[model samples]
Target: MAARVDVKLAELGISLPRPMQPIANYVPYVVTGNLVVVSGQVPAIDGKIAVTGKVSWSVSVDQGKEAARLCFINVLVHLKAACGGDLDRVRRVVRLGGFIASPSEFTQQALVMNGASDLAVAVFGEAGRHARTTIGVPSLPADAAVEVEGMFEIE
Candidate 1:
């Protein structure tokens, strides 16, 4: 039998990417009590960053959105590990923090972040509604266009 969330992922045509090992010393996720804090995830597919450069500068808004969604998919990969490989253990998506590589003049970080937020709702329904903070940063690790970190409440 598949986990309920696993079925949902299949229905959404989302195959959770293979887990990536941390490049630095920090762990990918920390589970303390009922909360799982996922580390920042870059838009890497098959271990290679899919998008790079600054939004509204070298990267277009639509591309940035795709990068954001990819980052969230990586976040989900880690979150599943934190939940013992069962996404159905998730109770709610408490929060998500999005960091976008952008110039100081760029002001559409929120719109770019919608990529991740929309997918969250699609996967988790109402439980995915979360508080979010979107920031336009000068750069992100590996020059990735987007980075996403999340806090999830799990059963």
Candidate 2:
């Protein structure tokens, strides 16, 4: 486990919760060979969507970005649990794909995704940095403000 991750998480007042199971057909994560694919996780906690609605419309861009941060936290929780709660087991983050619910006019998807990308680096240092994409969409399940999925290289 990396001490920097713990330090950053504490500094940010962030706590990773228990890993959650999928609500429907798909699994939360699937590990194939050295790659781990985490399903899209919304801004949820305790089986409830933490934030809902479209960015810059029903929700502010900042709020939506925070929601994106939470989704990334959830992804890390799942990853840690799968690897026996040891971040050292993760070699690196491969890709981060983010989906934001926003109006047609919203163009701050990249800025919103900074929350996730920033957190990843803060946690895993260089290994946490990865290729990423931020996409806008009409709506998401549970009407979540943001959703994020990830791929990681594991040891």
Candidate 3:
């Protein structure tokens, strides 16, 4: 039930931040059948990017990881909205896609994405374990250090 999940989130000291509106034309998430496909989210909090710039250049690997975490938190904000405010509707975290803004030589993308991956497990237990892809890119919207998107199975 969402109550349990809400309590868990509270216990974890995570209060879902306000959902960010699409900076472009796309909607935040689309529900088709049982799946909610979320749009990519950058590490924004309080309507501003929490971290920016290329990883391992101006940003450290740890900072990249934290940015990934912040992005996931933003993902949850929309995911909850897509679920009609009942997070319990989510049955599983099917997959996560992460894009790390980093130099061409950076190779620690997967490790940095662990920030989102780990939090998913913490929130959904076994259901949070998911297939994932992590990639390096030259830049992202707002020049955030990381961006994360997700696919969720819902009921």
- Full-model lDDT for every candidate: 0.95, 0.87, 0.93
| Root-mean-square deviation of Cα positions for candidate 2 versus the true structure, in angstroms | 1.8
- Segments in model 3 whose C-alpha atoms lie over 4 Å from true places: none
Better of 2 and 3 by lDDT: 3
Cα lDDT tens digits for candidate 2, 81-131: 667667677889999999999998899998888888888887888999999
Q: How far does residue 103 in candidate 2 sit from its true spot (Å)?
A: 1.1
Pick by TM-score: 2 or 3, better one: 3
Off by over 4 Å in 2: 1-4
lDDT of 3 by residue, 101-134 (tens): 9999999999999999999999899999999999
lDDT of candidate 1 over 35-64, digit per residue (tens): 999999999999999999999988999999
Over all chains combined, what TM-score does candidate 1 have?
A: 0.97
Error of 2 at 149 (Å): 0.2
Clashing pairs in 3: none
Model 3 backbone overlap count: 0
Poorest 10 consecutive residues by lDDT, candidate 1:
16-25
